[model samples]
Each structure stands twice: as structure tokens, then as C-alpha cells.
Target: MANQPQDDRTSKQQAIDDWLPITSSRNAKWWYSAFHNVTAMVGAGVLSLPYAMAELGWGPGIAILILSWVITLYTLWQMVEMHEMVPGKRFDRYHELGQYAFGEKLGLWIVVPQQLIVEVGVNIVYMVTGGKSLKKFHDTVCPSCTPIRSTYFIIIFASVHFVLSHLPNFNSISGVSLAAAVMSLSYSTIAWAASLRKGVKPDVDYSYKATTNTGVVFDFFSGLGEVAFAYAGHNVVLEIQATIPSTPDNPSKGPMWKGVVVAYIIVALCYFPVAIVGYYIFGNSVDDNILITLEKPTWLIAMANVFVVIHVIGSYQIFAMPVFDMLETFLVKKLHFRPSFFLRFVTRTTYVAFTMVVGICVPFFGSLLGFFGGFAFAPTTYFLPCIMWLAIHKPKRFSLSWIINWICIFLGVLLMILSPIGGLRSIIVSATKFGFFS
Candidate 1:
């Protein structure tokens, strides 16, 4: 028989119970998460790979391309598992998923570093890249204008970050995110148009120069970690999922999934062309900021400069918030005297100021992507999620392929650790191999 119309009620109730929104005044406008994801992912575009393409040629660059896709797809698979288990539940951090599946200790350990890299490491890179981009624009367009002092740029960048960070909540930020997207997209398009005009033929055979034999396997592992960090927008999923309204009938129920999909699509499109073109033009001579490949109209370069600078403010705000919040909650909560909101604001302001100064002071800070990719990327993106999935799903209870899965997990962890070390070494040793600027 048609059997009492089955039990749709249970699933419906589950969805409703799971729906949680991000606690911000801008509740009505919740799509900011998507914008942030897109921006964060694309932020990597400004870095040194274009030059790697110049060095390695298109074939190896294409290898890097494939590697990036594999890593992103694997992370995405883990995220899908995360969504299914929790459904609409809002998780404050990536490790929250781990906590749900495993326990608090493991979850915290895994997520803490992940959050730092995303918020702190990535943000620092953004600021540095933004600074470099602005400097280029200034030199090109306003050659006679006095070069921007680092202090002046830092103050301007930090002030903008403070103002934006204080906005009513994420909803307002989401709107700004859209504007950022348009600006970034326009910059990419213009840059592409200019790049195409150069009329460089793609080189099929870019010689493989293994600067150091770190072992092929180790190099691949290092490459894997770099790729994983490059594509990690996964934390957004946990938070966004938690923010979503869990109503059974609501089709757009999982905003995290929706946001990620939207963001990845935009990021992939924006990055691929730039990487491909940059490789073609520079032929192993590409700089970290791919725009350096373009000798374009002053207007285009100026627009790029302004947008990168503005985007840095939003990035730094996101980077510093959790750090400040964690400090206050863990330390200040027990302390007798609490600072007022304005005072707290000042505290955070001071902390960011310090980071800006330190970030600018260090010559090697720009290599953050490689550094964190080795140290933090694996545990968060691959190993932790796999562990969490096993914990949450309890695969043994369900008669799943435990042996194979665990093996994969171990290998993932090993590779994650190995990858960044190799990459970091490569960056440093590249100098020695080629003999002090070979």
C-alpha cells in the first residue's frame, strides 16, 4: 500500500530545528558570506604563481592547475558531508564540525590554526599585495607624485579596516562585497584585454628546472598543501550553515553551500584566465602580482590600485575580529575590569597597527601562503575533516570502508606536513640552485 504518506515530517522538523542565522543586525541581508568567500579565494590571485608559470612554463603551470582543482574538489566533498550531518545547524568555526563529530579537544586543536591562517595569514598577504599593487599604480600613473610612505599607507589601510569592521554587521559588508566583486572583475577584464593585446604565443615546452631534489614525492606533497590552502573557503561553510534558517520547505536552506558554489565559480573564472595569460606573457618571468605582466593604460592600473586597497580593509577586519574576540573571552572575561566598547576598539586598533608594522617590516611575510600551507593547511582542510566525518558519521557502525578511508586520511596528513616544508624550501633554495639570482 502507499503506506500512510511516509514520514516527511521528521526530515522537515530536522531542517527547521537546524536553521540558525548569524547574530548580526543585518539579518535581512545574509548573502555577505558568499561575497567574503569569493573575495578571500580570489585574494590568492595576486601572488607569485604567475612568475612560477614563467619559470616552469605552461605545462607545469597546467599541472599546478590540475592540482588546485583536485584539492578544492576534495575539500568540497568534505564540506558536503559536513552539511548533511548538521543540516541547518550554525557552527561558529570549522572545528565546530569536528566537535560535533568527535569531541571538543580535537575540534579546537584542528580549527584554531585553520582560523588563524584564514583570518590572519591570508589577510596579511592581502594587505601586502594591496600595498604592492597601489605602489605600482602610483609609480605608473602619477610618476611625479611623491612615493607613498609605508606609514601613511598603513594608517590609511588600518583606518578603513576599523570603520568597515564596525559596520552594522555582515549584511552591510555583503553589499560592499558585491561592490568589491565588480571592481575586481573589472580589473581582471581590463588586465586580460591588455594582456591579449601583447600577442605572445603560448610556449608548449617549458623546461623543468628542479632547483632542489627534495624528492619527487615530497615535492608533490608540498604542492598538494599549497593547492589546499589556496582553495580553502571551507570555514565559511560551517559559519554560513549555522546562519541559515532551517525550515523544511525552504529550498535555499543551506546558505553556506549556496555561497560556496557562487564564490568558487567566480574565483575559478577570475583566476584561470589570469594564470593562463600570465604564463603566456611572462613565460617563467611572471611576478607574484600578475598585473606586472601588463603594460596597460594608466586608468586601468589606477582602478586596480584603488580596488586592491579598498579590499584590504575588508580583509584585515575579518582577520583581526576573531583574534580580538578570543583574547577578550579567554583572558578578559575572568579579569575584574573590563574595557568599554570604545576602549576595546582601541585595543583591537592597536593590535592591527602592530601587525601592519610587523608585516611591513618582514621581507619574507609575502610568502605566507607557502608557509601556512605547510604548517596549517593540511590539518584543517584534509585531515581534520576526514576525522570529523568518521566521528560524525560513525562509519564502522554503518559498515563503511574504514580501512581505505583511514589510509587515505593518514596519507593526507603526511602529505600536508611535507608539502609546505618543501614549497618553503623551494622558495628559499631557488636562490641557491640558480646561484644567487640565476
Candidate 2:
């Protein structure tokens, strides 16, 4: 070991030493900091409300509420464990913890793909969201003009993202970030208010009931991916721990878990109401983007759209940055591409362009959200972290049935597979009906 070169340590290994400390002044209290984390998770979760409402209606719309209970329990347990594992280390990326907990190979396979999904999904989301927001704004501003188009807006927004991603201190957009938080709350509150005003009752008519029946089995599993994806952003713990003061005596005891818990609570409060109201107002008719259900004033919809657009952009960067950092580190070290400025630009531009194309081709949030949630996030969020916990801790006493854990994992996997298919079918059918494919 002494014979090894100093530069040989991997980035993952280096990050462990630079881990941020957890101190009162360094880390914000749960009250002040939790909403940031919570809102990010809710961003992805809220996007799927319209779709979930359409399939399951108000009865199973409560599935989101139910799932929050299960997710909270699972999250609390995970936080307890994470608090023990990651105090002093500068946990920059997911794989650092993965490598520390498990071995390198497992970390590479598990963390890498998961991060990719998050980044790509958020990018696609930003494009779709920004485009939609721009479309709405255009319509509001020029209701008499020809149908408002989104081509130019997409380009402008994408350009801004590229520029914003490169800024050093442009880490958080305070106003936009705050609006994302507030708009999410507002959207949910308004949705609930709308439901109450409209008197959204359960359909008692036999034909209405039968047609709306999302089979119990399908609803049970199908909803898992959506919920999993919605809650997957909890790994923000990696970022949260960075600002805390790291000391040996106080290393493990920190406020980060409090932040995580607080964040989850805010998320639950914001998302549950929105899901309930969404299902209440539209019943099975809710589209995937719940914003479509709003028969509100143009100003309100436009405001909501603006916030959603900014929220998507912020999310896109969160997922995008670490991946970019990892790739840049690899390229500079291995491929010798670090010396050239143009090469760096080319690399980033390529990534930006790829995301753009994906966003354009897959314009709808409903299908994209489902597919990403089911396939990518389900494994990372629900299954992988728990697996990592078991692998690292090797807890001899799990009184809780491993049977339930396995069942959750199996159901997670199944939902991931089904959400995409069902979501895509819904999109295709809608598109065909609208003459886009016909």
C-alpha cells in the first residue's frame, strides 16, 4: 500500500476524505432547509398526478397517500442508517457511498445507471415543462394569434440552461427555487380548492365505475413506480451533508437527517393534497400533466407554468452536474482531453444536444415520467439503497420479515416494467386520437 502512487486514489476515494462537517452554523436546521429537499422530490412526483388520477380515480388516488406512509417508514429507516455511515466524508456522488458501503463493481453498476436516469429524466422534463410553459404564455399573451408555437422558446431555454450550468456561483436560483416550492404548494392547494368547489364525488354509476376500474393488481403495482420515482430525490443527503462541520466526536450526529425528514414531511403535505384534489376534480379524466385540468385564470396558469418551468431547469442541473463532473474527471485523467477548452465545450454541447433531441421527440411528460420512474428510479431509490444498507451493516437482527422486503423489491421491479408500457400506450392512443400519428 505504501508503494502505491499518491495520485492513484480514485475520485470516489478522494471524496470520502473531503466530506463536509455537520455543525449548527454550517448546516441549516430542519425548519429552514428541509423544504428545498422536499420540493425537489415532489417535482418529479407531482408531474405524474394527472396520469395517476386518470387511471385510478379518487379511490386509489389515495394510493399516493398510502404510499407516502410506506415511503416515510422506509425513508426514516434509511436516514437512520445514512446518518451512521456518511458524516465526515465529502459524499459528492451516489457511488461514493455505494463504494464505501458495497464494493466498487456493484457501486459502478448501481449508482452510475441510477444517476444517468435521474439526469436524463430531469433534462427531458425541463424541455417538456419549459416548452409547455412557453406555449401557455404565448397563448395567454396572444389569444387571437395563430396557434402558439414552442420551437423558439425551447432553443432559448436550452441556451440559457447551457450557460447557467457553467456558472460558478450560480448553484441555486433563490427566487426561482422559492417559486418552485411555493408554486407546488399553490398548485396543490388550488387543485384541492377546485375539487371542493366542483364537488368531485366518486362515480357510483355502474358503467362509470367499471370503465374507471384500474384493476386492483395493476393499480397496486403500477402505482409503485410512480411513487418510487416521486420520492427518489431523497438522496440529496449527499449534498446536504457537505455543509455540515465534521468532527470525530460529532461526526455521526448531525442535522442532515433532520433535514431529510423535514423535506419528506413537506413533500408529503404538498403532494398528497395535489393528488387528492387532482383525482377529485377530474376523476379518471385527469391528463398526465395535471396542469391541464386547471380551468383557472390565464394569469394563474401562466404563473404555475413559469414556476414549473424553472423547477424543471433546477432539477435538470442537479442530475446533470455530477454526471458531467464524473465524466470530465475521467476524460481529463484517462483520455487526456483536459488540456483543450474546445473539447470540453464539445463534450458538454453534445450532452446538451442529446437531451434536447430526446426532449423534443418525447414531448409528453406522462409517458416519460412513467418510463423513467418505473425503469430507472425504482431500482435506485427503493431497492438499491436498502440492498446497500443490508450489505454494509449486515444487521444480524431484522425482526421485520425479509419476506416483505423481497415482496417490495419484486413489486418495485414489476411496477417499473409496467409504468412505461401503460404510460406509453396512453400517450400513443392519445396522440393517434389527436391525429399526430394518424
Candidate 3:
């Protein structure tokens, strides 16, 4: 009879999770994993690759691009493998996995804040990305049309989310995510192909654009952050895996890894051509956004911008679903609010509005990428999984696994420290030049 209360609590908690956005479904297919990862990873950050390469220069730029691909794939693999590590216990969320690796309270403290930063930050950036792209598309298609303020475009973008944010779970958004994946690939192809056809600029300068040593050093730092931002999938890897069903014979990891491999390949296809070909074509003079740099092909660039809008629409939801889960979980579980359509509607709408407002207020695309990328993306996407692997498995000292994990840790930490400095400086400078909502 005494156990009845505990059992009641357990049942109630399970019911709450089932009602929540992320944990409500677990029947997603391998293909669902593929596109969701694609949507989540190949986002606004990809649009900025040539810009990043411009800041990085040739050798270091190419090297960093390749290295980020390898390291993030490694970290993503670790996340997929660890999703069901504790036998029947599956980590349905990033924070849940953190709780397992670091214990209940400490795990929440360490992981939740960083995970929130990555997810929320992505949503905010995607708002600006979606809005700005829409504005670009309008301008490209109708140069004579009255120019719309970016703030209004941003508002139009957020209006879509206000409705879509009510999607109950990851499974519900699969179609959107699939379309998003297609659009991402489509736009990325357009970006690089167009850049290639444009050919190298007349007297293209490959030299670093910075006039001073300090400027060059800081640009290098900001470039690291930009690259870090491109590989932002690790933040959502576990959650993406959570949607897939698992069994002893057919573990989720098998299919999740397959999907991830496909997704990473797509990521490479999208990232490399845009970063390399676009940089090769434009060099240090590349616009922070490659699409902006390609102006001659009006119809094609306009279409690419539309594709960008559609892709980020899906990408925004991919990232926002987790934030919805977090907020709903907190409200229902901690505050004793009853879970219902009203609660969810209010919660999700509020979140979408919040991101939209912030995005409109500070639409500093390049600087936002660098700041959030280094401050949050590096730790979560680059090294946190390695830290978790070591903590959980305790691999033997000085072994290959041990050595590699430590190397990733060292690099990730360095990235975390340096990238923000440059990003912040850029934001400050941009703020001085561009007034709020200007």
C-alpha cells in the first residue's frame, strides 16, 4: 500500500512525458533520422561558410572545414551509440543523457543550460536567417517593389512558427523536416554552382582582409566559431535518436547511425562546395553570406533565397521542438500545471515570439554565428560527447580512444575560449554602425 504513492507518481510522470513534444513518439524511421539531422545541421550556418573561409584563408580554412566534419561525425557517432547504453534505459533528451552520465542534479546543471543555448540560439538565428532570406528573395524578384524593413519580414517569418510550433512531437514534423532537407540541399547546390559559374573575381585577393595583425588574429578566432556553428547537430543527436524505436535485436543505434552517416554525407556535400568553390570564386571579398555576394543571376539567386526560407522554416522547428519540450516539461512537471492544449499552445507560442523578437532586435548574422557557435556550439557539438564517453566507459588511459578523446577535448576548449572574443568584437562594431532594427 505504501508503494502505491510512488507508483502513482511514476505513472503520472510517464503520462506527462507521453504528452510532451519529444517523448510522445518513438516510431520514426531511419529516413526520418536522415532528414531531421540534415535539417538540423545544414542550416543558416552553411550560408555563412564562404564568409568563414574568407576570414580563415586557404590552408587553415580547408583544414578546419575537413577537421570539423570528421570530429563532429565522431562525436555524433558517440551520441548515437550512447543513446541506449544503459540496457533498457533510453535517453530521450540531451539533458536526460546528461543526468545519466553525471547523476541527476549535476547533469541538469551542466547540460541543460548549454543544450538550451544551442537550441534556442539556433532558433533565434534561423529567425533572422529566414527573415533576411525572404527579404532578399523579394528584392531579387521585384527590385522596383517598395523595400520592406527586415523587422517586418522577421514578423512574417515568426507568424508561421506561431502556428507550426504547436506540432506535438518530432514525428509530427517529419514531412516538414523532409521538405526542409530537400530545400537545404537544393539551396546549397545553387549557392556553390552559382559561385562556380560566376568564376573568380577580377584580381581576386586571397590575402586576409584584415589590415592589422590584431584584426587578422581576431578574424581567425571568429572563423573558428563560424566553422563550429556549421556542425551544430550534436546538440540534437540524442533527441533525434529518441524518436526511433529500439529492441534487443534491432537497436536504435544501428538505424540511427545509418541515418546519421547519410546525413553527414549530405552535410559534406552542402558544406564543402559552398565553402571551397565559393571561396575560390570570391576569395577574401566574399560576403558574409554567399548568396548576397552572387547578384548577377537574379532569378536563380531569388530561388535560392526562397529555398533558404523554406529550409530554415523546417530547421527552426527542428530546433524549437526541443525548447518546447523543455519549457512544457518545466511548467507541467515543476510548477504543477496541468498538461493540455491550452498550456502547450501558450508555451510554444511564447517561445516562438521570444526568439523572433530577439532575432529582429539583433540581426547580426555573422557575429551571432561566431558568438553562439563558440560560446555554446563548441562544448556541446565538439567535446561534450567525448567527455560523456569517458565518464561512462572509462576507457583505459593512453589508449587510442583515450588519446583521441583528450585531443578533441583540448581543441574544443580552445575553440570555446577564443571564438567568442572575436565574435563579440564584431557584434560591438556592427552595433555601432547598424542601429537596433535598422
- Best by the lDDT measure: 3
Worst 10 residues of 3 by lDDT: 1-10
TM-score of 3: 0.96
**Model 1 residue 316 lDDT?**
52
RMSD of 1: 6.7
Candidate 3 segments exceeding 4 Å error? 1-9
Clash count list over all predictions:
15, 9, 0
C-alpha TM-score for every candidate: 0.78, 0.79, 0.96
Residue 21 C-alpha lDDT in model 1: 22
**Candidate 1 ranges with C-alpha deviation above 4 Å:** 1-22, 25-31, 44-47, 54-60, 80-89, 201-205, 209-226, 248-253, 331-340, 396-415, 426-438
**Pairs clashing in candidate 2?**
19-89, 19-90, 21-244, 21-245, 21-246, 22-244, 22-245, 23-245, 374-416
Q: List the residue pairs that clash in candidate 3.
A: none
What tens digits encode model 2's per-residue C-alpha lDDT throughout 149-245? 5656666668867775653211343334455566666656655565566665566221122334455445444455566667666454454444454
Q: Which of 1 and 2 is ahead in TM-score? A: 2
In model 1, the Cα lDDT at residue 345 comes to 64
Deviating ranges (above 4 Å) for candidate 2: 1-35, 44-47, 57-59, 76-80, 83-90, 169-176, 198-224, 336-349, 401-407, 427-438
User: Rank order by lDDT, top first?
Assistant: 3, 2, 1
lDDT of each: 0.56, 0.58, 0.89
What would the per-residue lDDT of candidate 3 be over residues 313-389, giving only the tens digit for each residue?
99999998888888888899899999999999888888998999998888875466677678789999989999999
